[model samples]
Target: MADPVKHYQSEGHDALSAISQAQRIAFAPMLFQASWCLREIGVLAYLEDRGKEGATTAEIASHCAIGEYGAGVLLDMGLGGGLCHLVGDHYVLGKVGKYLQNDPMTRVNMDFTQHVCYQPLAHLLDAIRAGKPEGLQVFNPEWATIYPHLDALPEPARASWFAFDHFYSDWAFQQAQEHVLGYAPRTLYDVGGNTGKWALSCAARDPELEVTILDLPEQLALAQPRIEAAGMTARVTGHGVNMLDAEGPLPGEADIWWMSQFLDCFSHAQIVVILKRIRQHMKPGARVCILELFWDRQSFEAASFSLNATSLYFTAIANGNSRFYHSKEMYQCLREAGFHVEAEHEIPGPGHTLLVARPLPQPS
Candidate 1:
């Protein structure tokens, strides 16, 4: 195998560059909070509306209904952070600022961080030391995993969590549908199907297709209704079970077993268990499709960076044992679970990779 580092693009840095990078790292939290404040306080919105003409500090303060001093402080921070540009006495939204205001992905990510990650992230070191989700205490004290107690999360946080979860995967569904349909499967089992989005999509694609969702009870409550709302209740059904339970029974004979952005929520050992369970239940020649964002397989440095950063979130809150897997790690898990990669498909947009694996024949 070629050196994985060969693909990494490096910016040749001088002493000044190193100093600049160090300063950015040291002040990142402050910059992030300031930018969030700028967006929440209406500074970015007002500037975005103004366009090239921009808005004066006093005008922004009056429009946003805040004191001019506070407004000025945030505006200065925005200017420093490159979120906005200062032209004479007026401020205009920068490229980054416009994204913060208009991008759906940005909105969801920011809200998710604010609601689900921020407080818990503070305890990340503790979580790492304990090898458990120490930060999950912020949401539910009894549950170790976030999925089990998702419904109990405080109002907007719950809303933000689902929105964040769906927004990332929904875009990839259109691409995934084509891959799954190519095999002409009559029955599709959606493991970890949170809100039945994929099931609804499949129902529309093939009316006669039987779609079953396997997830926790709390998740099914949200999914069953959406399936009905999509008028897919006849074709789509929910089966409540914990995928993480090693000894749990799994329904068999599905032609296609699909897991979208789901396996990354587990450790390597757990992934093997889940895959082995699926293999045991699946019919002969059945295919298991795994859709995930593998850090090493990403086309860009930023995508890999974002994924690596998210792995910390898993350590601190999600499961405390899972991470964004490298493609090699996933392959090893598949091999250990008595499966071989039949095909690998790289999906467009946001660096998602799909692995289609087939179960090895069991000995007589």
Candidate 2:
């Protein structure tokens, strides 16, 4: 194929790097809001607003609502990010504007994450200090509360989360597929896989596989339509269960079990107990994939910061263990539960890692 890429020194990439590095608290809210407009910046909707005619800097500033000085900076920053056109005194959306909407595909997703996920997240420092999220009795409201209202939000809000449908699914499934060393895994189970995104992907790629998702009645009720809408009526299936309830595995069998972004709802002891229960369902060759924001110490990025902060909200409001785990720390927990790592992969983009492990081989 023609060269994979043509440009190396992209200012947009660098600007995002700045966004990824700086903590949410460090930037002025104005800049943060501008950055929030990122998905829309180099998108077609922005171009449409120009009506095929470019405008002066003052006009652009008037449109975006800011002073001339600030607008100049915004234009420069957008240019650095490859989202603006500056030809002499006139400006327009950049060439990149053809692809993304002036608004992001996940605008609604951003609102949900920003409003629901970030508020409690911002309280992490306070939680660490006062040791709680405000005066709320619990720290983790994810499973307990998030489930009931997910469908209540408009489709655009849910759709705002671009990662949930494709990228996130791939990140979690590829970890499992690669961890198995490319073998056609026999049986894989995705617990609480709402919308069956990951399960459907796994089943599609490997025809020999059978996958099931266990989730609450309400989520499953809402998710069935989407699953059918995606035409994954057979490759993937669902079951309703209270994940927190004491229970045993499915009646017949399980060779591999996957929990993507499911463990953050409980305490470590609770997770251990859950794993212990899941262990009994394995057929000697089984492995489990745990996908979440297992924190890394090397460096932090914007997505990572957002993810880590989101988890902190879980810790403060629902369960104390809501903050993301360090890799080594999670491995320790896995070890205590009789699982040793078989493989690990950090998916592309940000704020997610996958750990796949089998029950430690028992010796005779």
Candidate 3:
């Protein structure tokens, strides 16, 4: 089928524009199904424990509970999708998918996104505009889900710390601690941390500090296995906490409060309230560190585009907002929460700023 949307934009290179536009319009419908098929077939082949040794589409269909016709259809399209390879009449994972056969590094990512991300991404645009009052319903299709899920966020934050997880973080830990706080504080807490990657890094480098994570039952169920595997169980521990309720206070006051890629799910007032609550749990020298997208007057184009597209997705499915806030604008909010904002650094590509906020001492 010829694409109705052509290379009308003159800004991009002709070759790139023509190919990009055509691909966009060409597989528009398949966008929703593509991930599912790739994941499904990949899992099926893995279940057979066939590494390089392939399986027929009929066998894959039977194992995956999909019809032979459906399996055939997936193979027909998935080959070009870079998800599978065709061996005459038989089908197997392609070069791209060979990684998924038994590699924990490969399969873990697909599972994480399919189970954890697919739902929220289903409504990424909806989350951006909710502005805090309307929360994203990722786990629950009907009810509002927050806090515990928010706690487990750090692992994904860690996994996604860098741009390489292709579509995904050791840096969230480094940024959460060193870059965000700059060693000005003594203790740090990563609320909703998943695998405790941030804390592991923080504790490894700074032996003087203590870090904590709070998350939900389900996320913890998944995170527990990973945390144990990572073997940082001594430095990092989990506390059962829920943020949606009115009474989920910090277990103790700390020198710093860290919310990695957190705080985007609430309204402005909600952010103020959360900060104020942190104020109650904070010591005189406490600090707040946030790793999020911080925009400025002279905006970077790549950062702008990623934020725009992602915010839209947040709004559509999650009924939440990304809140691409400016520096002074964020400082205003921090001031209202009784904190003094410090420096903000913006790296290249859909940038995330390491923002540090030092707490205000008592007034005379």
Candidate 4:
């Protein structure tokens, strides 16, 4: 079946539109910084507060306490970027400007770019050339991947990383709980369960349910106090191990394996290995639920843009070999792991798709 939502046209552009797009790409860095400063320094918010009548540059400068020269340049750049509108001497928030101030996704993306991906992205060319996560050198010289050092990342970077992760996955948790709990699975495995958000939620929701989170030791350490604080220490536990370590095996006690925003952290080959390992350990009748933002499955072009851009972040910082896989690629991995997708669901949020798979019955 063809995907009606997936369409990318390859067409020639006229001279003016071509040049306009080229200029947008060329000045994107400057515009991004300008937008960030405007948001951080209160220019965007001030204009938003001023409403449709907007505010003059003098008023903005006075309110923000920046010099008129500084305010004017940012505001002008905002106009060029369609982030603000200049009518007469007043500056009003454009559609883009409003979202910049009020959108949670925008805020998370900005902070993540600034604190986590910004410096690392400078080494993206090196990473691509070497086919490795060379950009992670920004954080630590010894670490081969970002997962192990997540807890140890510097203040704003660590905060920003979690914020970015949660911003995309958190909204889907409620729907996820409903979907999984409907099956009445007594035991759940939370793979790559950072900080135990899902574990904490599921355990609290079902008195009979127990959750085991499998992640690196550092991440488990961070989740420990939180689980204890939630008074779910008995029901929710952390298993400290690297899922990518082929020699190590997953616990087979889980009635359901839940991986949310997890599988994309590994390459296609690694995804197969991880899935195969899980299949080996899954209890009879157990199911694996995978939640991801598959680029080819996105409903909108903007969502696709975000996921595609995130694939680069994975290459440059998180790990060198993974990507935001297409849905077909994910399905292929499931089949290779000896599981068949029994159901597919669209989580009630942006860019999330869930695949529920069951193990292929063993031959007699």
TM-score of each: 0.94, 0.66, 0.57, 0.96
Q: Model 3 clash tally?
A: 34
Clashes of each: 0, 17, 34, 0
For model 4, name the residue pairs that clash: none
lDDT of 2 at 143: 39
- lDDT (tens digit, per residue) of candidate 2 on 1-364: 1221222225454777777656444654544355446443432354457755766667766665656776667666556545566777776677554333433334433554554444455555665676444413222333334444556544544454334434444544665556543645676777777767777777777777777778877767766887788777776778777666657445336566878777766667767777766765677667787776655521344444545645655655444455566567677778877888887766654446667788886667
Better of 2 and 3 by lDDT: 2
Give the distance in Å from residue 93's predicted Cα in candidate 2 to where it truly belongs.
Answer: 9.2
Q: Which should have the higher lDDT, number 1 or number 2? A: 1
- Stretches of model 3 off by over 4 angstroms after superposition: 1-143, 146-172, 175-177, 217-221, 244-248, 295-299, 319-329, 347-350, 361-363
All candidates: CA RMSD (Å): 2.1, 7.5, 8.5, 1.7
Better of 1 and 2 by TM-score: 1
- Local error of candidate 2 at 19, Å? 18
What lDDT tens digits, residue by residue, belong to model 4 across residues 1-364? 2452446655457989999999999988899999999999998888888899999989999999999999999999999988999788899899999999999999999999888888899999999998789999999988888987898899899999999998889989998788889999999999999999999999989999999999988889989999989999889998988887877967889988999999999988899899988988888889999998887777777788888898989999888889898899999999988899999998757768889999898789
**Top candidate, metric lDDT:** 4
Q: Rate the local accuracy (lDDT) of all candidates.
A: 0.88, 0.60, 0.57, 0.89
> How close to the true structure is residue 87 of candidate 3, measured as C-alpha lDDT?
68
Better of 1 and 3 by TM-score: 1
Candidate 1 displacement at residue 106 in angstroms: 1.7
Residue 9, candidate 4: Cα error in Å is 3.5
